[model samples]
Target: MNSLPDLLRLLAVPAFAWVAWRDIATRRVPDRVWLPLLLVAGVALLFEFFTINGSPTRRFFLVRVGLSAGLVVPLSYAFWRLGGFGGADAKAFIVLSVLFPAYPAYRLLEFSFPGVETALGIFSLTIVTNAVLVGIFYPVALAARNALAGEVSLRSFVARPIPAADATTEYGRLLDVGPGRGGLDLDALRMYLRWRGHTLEELRADRSTYRHSRSLPEERNPPGDGAIRTTAA
Candidate 1:
């Protein structure tokens, strides 16, 4: 019974794993996923309070949980507002703060857990710190993912690679034919593609279609306006 709260909190790990997979695939998580975790954490916390037999111990528990939550919620919110965190990621952190307000220390089925803790022993903050530390390997992870899929692009770490046949339907900006692409100076070509509402692949499929346009947006003018009106070749 003494370890019930910690075990309940442990449920959050697998829940977050599902959330991470969903976030990577569709960037969406239904609100329903969090409510159950929150409910369990709340109920377990109340049970822990009731189980406590002394005033000082209960007060200490309250102080630990309250301080952990008070510190994490604001920091997660600030990161979300600054665009440094996704809204789902921010919510995950906040939920984690509630679920694990303080370190979980107990032996379960003969397996000792959390043999050591940070100086503060604030579990929520520890989770955040570990997340930041793990994030340092994200670039390497990206590179590896792209490599395994044979997406050996110069911008593989940051860009998504799709077949040229699906360029019109795919959701991403042109990387190979961007305005800033050097050598061939395809910037003008890029502007022309934008003005004509065409993808580079479409133009390349039949250059004769886009090579002779009725109007060409001047370099200084907005993409929609084609004041130059000289056959854009």
Candidate 2:
């Protein structure tokens, strides 16, 4: 009976691993990946409630699961709304809260928390913390790669100045100089210009007209080779 919790915890490991791998490779996790795990977790919780009679552990487990759901669901939704998390990422967090509401005792590196509740009781919080700690290295790795590639000069990397004209688009691709920031805001600019009965070509050709336009930066240079490069714009 004591081993029942351990068994349920062991069952969840592979399912979680599979979801993690799928998310890494494809940036998506299908319903099939988490649904069975959710079902199993539900069954395990019910089994523990009915079969484990000697302690208040079952009620405690229920409370942990409820707290995990209450805390994680709204947090995940908020992250999604803020554009910090995708739909798939939010769902994955919710599924994980159910599958691992508390820590399993049969795992490696067991330790006491002193005054702290066992780390497993707040499993979702640990997951978020671990993710954030791991993610902190990504920008460092990107900077290292850029330095090695010579895309980032040592002076530029160290100084990190706000440039008068950024040569590259937000996606890190080079662009011919025109209206630097305006290029990124082209759609809104286009609608405004069109509303004022001016075509983009007309604006590009007449520097005075381009400068006079509201909510638009003055075009610094003429169109390149008669092409309005809109890919990044």
Candidate 2 collision pairs:
103-120
Which candidate number maximizes lDDT?
1
Worst 10 residues of 2 by lDDT: 167-176
lDDT of 2 by residue, 1-233 (tens): 23585587578778777766665544445676668777877777677667766567767877888888888878888878987677777777877777667764543356532234554566776676566676667666666766766667544332232243331211222232355532233333434554555565665677675675363654533332222234321
**What range of 10 consecutive residues in model 1 has the weakest lDDT sum?**
224-233
Strongest candidate by TM-score: 1
Q: Note each model's CA RMSD in angstroms.
A: 10.1, 10.6
Model 1 stretches with alpha carbons more than 4 Å out: 137-177, 180-233
